[model samples]
Target: MKIDEAVEIVKPHLTKSRFEHTLRVADTAVELTDVFGGSREKIELAAVFHDYAKCKPAEEMKQFILECDELPNNLLDYHHELWHGPVASVLIDREYGIIDDEIKSAIYCHTTGKEKMSRMDRIIFVADYIEPGRSFPGIDEVRKAARYDLQLASWMALRNTIQFLVSKNATVYPDTFYAYNELTRQINGGY
Candidate 1:
């Protein structure tokens, strides 16, 4: 799908601020593609719809998890904040016929990132986290690292996420741990 069509499809589904964030993510994803070398089209589409399900009702998201065979049941045990990406992945395919595996996977795991992420997945994941509007304690470091190394940038983002969740005493999703471990191994021999 063209970027403009994808944007139009998602705009009405998102609040104004979120819509703007999506645009920024697409921009960041394209920039990452330029630097890191991936399919710019796939990266843009995935980033444009990464947050497609962000504002979904919690119960509705739960239902999607319950009914979709592709989604794991364990997702219900975690915070709903992590549901949007997986839910959006399924919905975009069902609702809009976006059946590209790369796009779906990127959207599916954009939030909690899975182990062995594809280059496009890493781009979208890092793009979503370090998009310009996102202001947090360690985001600048991730953004700066993103300009050079995608994997290193992803590791930093995952580390910051895990640290933030730990500090808040929030439940960290298992996939988040798995992704962090995989990246750690790739970057630092799992030290």
Candidate 2:
């Protein structure tokens, strides 16, 4: 699907703030794709559809997943925040016929990230975190690091996320730990 069409489809599902954030993420992903030598089209498509299932009611998301026999067992225990990205990926693939692996992977990992992330995965993850509309603490530093150091920026962003989760006493998803460890290993290896 085209970026605009994807935006239109997801627009009604998001609040004004989230819709704006999505647009910013799309634009940021495009810019990062240009700078980092990835696929701009894939990045934009992933960004536009990344949160496609985010605002769905919990029961609705669960019901949709239950109706689909091929859904992953890994998704069974996800709470709302953890479920949204993968659920959105499945919905985008099924509903909009967005079947690109890079795009799907970006959407799949945008929330918590994963080990051995692709260039597109890193782009989408950083774009979502450092998008212009996002205003969480330490975002400015992440955005600044993104301009010159992709690996460092990813480490900072993941670190911030881990710290935030710890502060809130929120559950730390396994993928987050995997991503953090992978990123830490990369940084330590002088990447």
Candidate 3:
């Protein structure tokens, strides 16, 4: 589906602020695609729908996951933010017939990134964290890194995420550990 159509479908599900953030992420994703050499269409679509399940009632999201058999296994153990990405992926595919592998993978890994992310995944992940509307402590640095080096920005963001989760005593999803390890490996010349 087109970006406009995806936005229209997502509009009702998000708060006004989140809807605007989605637009910024889509725009950012497109820009990153041009710079990073990925399919602009896929990046745009993935960014537009990355948070499609964000505003869903937690109970409802959990119930949907319980009912859907194809949801990822890692999501089943940590059903909090862990389910958001995979659930959003399923919803975007089922509701909008968005079948592009790049787009789907981007959405699937947007929340808690994976090892060896694709260009589209990096774009969506960084865009979501460093979008214009974001105002976190290290956002400016992340935004700058995103412009110069997508992988570096992602690694920093993942590090910050893991630290934040640890501070809050929040459950760290396995994917977050895997993502951090993968990025650290890349940074350490393990590739």
Residue 68, model 1, lDDT: 91
TM-score of each model, in listed order: 0.98, 0.92, 0.93
For 18-87, candidate 3 gives per-residue lDDT tens digits of 8999999999888888888877877888898898888888788788888888685556677476677788
Highest lDDT among the candidates is held by which one?
1
- What order do you get sorting by lDDT, best first? 1, 3, 2
In candidate 1, stretches whose alpha carbon ends up further than 4 angstroms from where it belongs are none
Candidate 3 — worst ten consecutive residues by lDDT sum?
72-81
Q: What ranking emerges by TM-score with the best candidate at the front?
A: 1, 3, 2
Q: Model 3 residue 189 lDDT?
A: 89
How well is each residue in 79-163 modelled by candidate 2, as lDDT tens digits? Answer: 5677778888788878878888888989988988888888888899999999987788999999999998877888788899999
lDDT of each: 0.94, 0.84, 0.84
The prediction achieving the highest TM-score against the true structure is 1
Residue range 25-102, candidate 1, lDDT tens digits: 999999999999989998999999999999889999999899899999999999999999999999999999999999
